[model samples]
Target: MRLDERIVPYLHMAGLYHLVRLNETWFRSDESLVSAFMERWRPETHMFHMPFGKCTITLQDMAYQLGLPIDGNYVSGCLMDFERYIKGGHPAWMRFEELLGVLPLANCIDKFTVKCSWMQETFGKLPHGVNDATVKRYARAYTMMLLGTQLFGDKFGTCLHIR
Candidate 1:
């Protein structure tokens, strides 16, 4: 299947570079309104607006949790398909596109992949437990957390500095 045709997982989505890039836009605008809510609303969990759901180990958090090497150059994008995913449709996705304004995403995304080799080699499954990505999404949170946090401090510098 084409890469974009496959839903990109948070596993590969929340790279430091990707998050930082996103936050660069997010924090400066009204998007910041969600920060306080995001932090306290559910607390360190993957979230979707409809069905009132949450995934404790959303793929984005897993990268940091698993101590996966962060690829600063890594390019990640959530496929801009929301009407089907959101029952009533929340504006976060649309707002996000607005926050981004515009970019050379088409040029960049074609070259991207889940940067963590171990994540792919070991996890070997698509994202789950949140959104349409699948249901086991939250299943690996605890185990991956235990594994990643143990090494995060030690490997953090490397992950951040690597590119």
Candidate 2:
């Protein structure tokens, strides 16, 4: 199999690769629908108060829509460790440099943020005969890109928090 094909197992293991295909046609945003939803959203009740009745989207709904595995516990990272990644001073940066083979310039890094486009352009393609460690790193870069472009996408949507 090709080297690019190797990353499939890693992404599949993480339950993310399938989401990439959704972007081909299934993924789309409707501003008017979003506005309508927002208009009826009740944060206090955590439900949508419609003229008919109040209802809420369950985890199952999200799982069904996004093809995410709902069986696993909610995964989250510690923000406290973010300070250690600043300015390439910490060992985490060293590990990143080792995996990616290059660090973004100091000017390009905004606190814990880096341009997702820069990351995609930099590590998007893996070198031939790369070791498992290198392939894992590429998988991680793709994961970050997927997250930044899909679920947690912000208005600007240009950069992602690297921490």
Top candidate by TM-score? 2
Candidate 1, residue 29: how far the Cα is off, in Å: 5.3
In the range 61-115, model 1's lDDT, one tens digit per residue, is 7566444565466533344543334435644434323422222233222221112
Give model 1's clash tally: 7
**Candidate 1 runs further than 4 Å off:** 1-33, 43-51, 57-163
Model 1 local distance difference test score? 0.33
Cα lDDT, all candidates: 0.33, 0.73
Candidate 2 TM-score, C-alpha based:
0.66
Clashing pairs in 1: 10-59, 65-148, 72-163, 128-137, 129-135, 129-136, 129-137
Question: Cα lDDT of model 2 overall?
Answer: 0.73
Q: Which ten residues in a row have the lowest lDDT in candidate 1?
A: 154-163
Q: What TM-score, over all chains together, does every model reach?
A: 0.17, 0.66
Candidate 2 lowest-lDDT run of ten: 83-92
**Candidate 2 Cα errors over 4 Å, as ranges:** 1-3, 25-57, 77-101
